[model samples]
Target: MTPTQRHRVLALTPYARLLSVWQTLGIHTDHRCVRGPDTGMAMVRGRMGGSGNAFNLGEMTVTRASVVLEDGSLGHGWVAGRNKPQAELIALIDACARQQAWARRIDSELVEPLAEALEEERQQASQAAAATRVDFFTMVRGE
Candidate 1:
């Protein structure tokens, strides 16, 4: 897969699902973290009304990690929470997924299932939101 595809897969997956998948695989890996899973606030910038001037929205908590697998593949993981263990696991998975031996299994077993689950969750949320939407219209008055 292309680097963009790999990134998209990782970004879309929830940390909980990632953990579950890793546990299910039961793969023994020896790796070390090159960077911390430290939590910090990241400044969020946004444009007003979707196309207006950019401004700082606020800061959000984020955790990032970097891990190098035994095969020397370096993987980086960043998530939107202060979950250090989750970040570490994600980094490990990222490294493992890049290996030729583990690539196929990781993609098929972890990425695919997680992607499907995420999509289903999004669909359900969209449906629920749509059900609550209200449309207002002007009623014509006969004179």
Candidate 2:
């Protein structure tokens, strides 16, 4: 089947746990937020006595994430800004929830690469922190 067909099924799979694995390994994305133009506005009149004007100026912020599989299938998820991880996790899950042959390819290729990258980052961070190790001492007053 086509990559698109496979992606559709993978998109429905339960892959939220993958995101946690990624986070544990330190491979993560920055927060992404989207705000649409306001659709409602208030009218204001000139203090000197002029006609009032009305405009649209209402807006809300929406957070989302996108993941592309090895076979080129893309998945996206929208969530609240406070739940950025959830959004990314959902996106990845959807990308793997498909039943197409391409889904297996994507899991092996794309997901594997991502997991490796995350693990590498975690190791680097650990090494860096270790390099800054310090020891402290306290005096004995009873002596």
Candidate 3:
């Protein structure tokens, strides 16, 4: 593949990583729920705080991207938020799906680093939270 093709393939690694992590954790963000062209806009209905009756959250703008490979194959990706990476991933995955030759380059250079970075960030956040942990105790009263 040419340098441009390589770069394009590389660019999609993070999106794959993000999707993988999101799926692994079972986080119910709009990223995983919606699909297709209408993915960018969905009338999500859910309880505000798990107490009140269900309500429509109205139409929220989302991001959806697709890539068409040289061989006329397509791969699609989407996320609820306006995260650029999510859109880019969708496009790249589409490209990769269409052009299987680019898959190895994308997986090694792009996907691996994206996953590593995310894992590192998660670890740091967890450590930070752990550091601030507090202990509580109660004293017995004598009658």
Model 3 poorest 10 in a row by lDDT = 25-34
Task: Rank by lDDT, highest first.
Answer: 1, 3, 2
Q: Encode model 1's per-residue lDDT on 1-143: one tens digit a residue.
A: 65456656676676676777778988889999999978898999999999999999999998989999877889888878798987788888888888889888888887778778888999999999999999999999997
- Which candidate leads in lDDT? 1
Whole-model lDDT, candidate 3? 0.56
lDDT, each prediction:
0.83, 0.50, 0.56
| Consecutive 10-residue window with the lowest summed lDDT within model 2 | 33-42
Sorting all predicted structures by TM-score, with the top scorer first, yields 1, 3, 2
Candidate 2, residues 32-135, lDDT tens digits: the string is 22322112222333433334564444434444667776566566655433355555565655555453643565556545555566667779999999989986
The Cα error of candidate 3 at residue 44, in Å, is: 4.2
Residue 28 in candidate 2 has what lDDT? 32
Q: Give the TM-score of candidate 3.
A: 0.53
The TM-score leader among the candidates is: 1
Error at 102, model 1, angstroms: 0.9
Q: Could you tell me the lDDT of residue 104 within candidate 2? A: 60
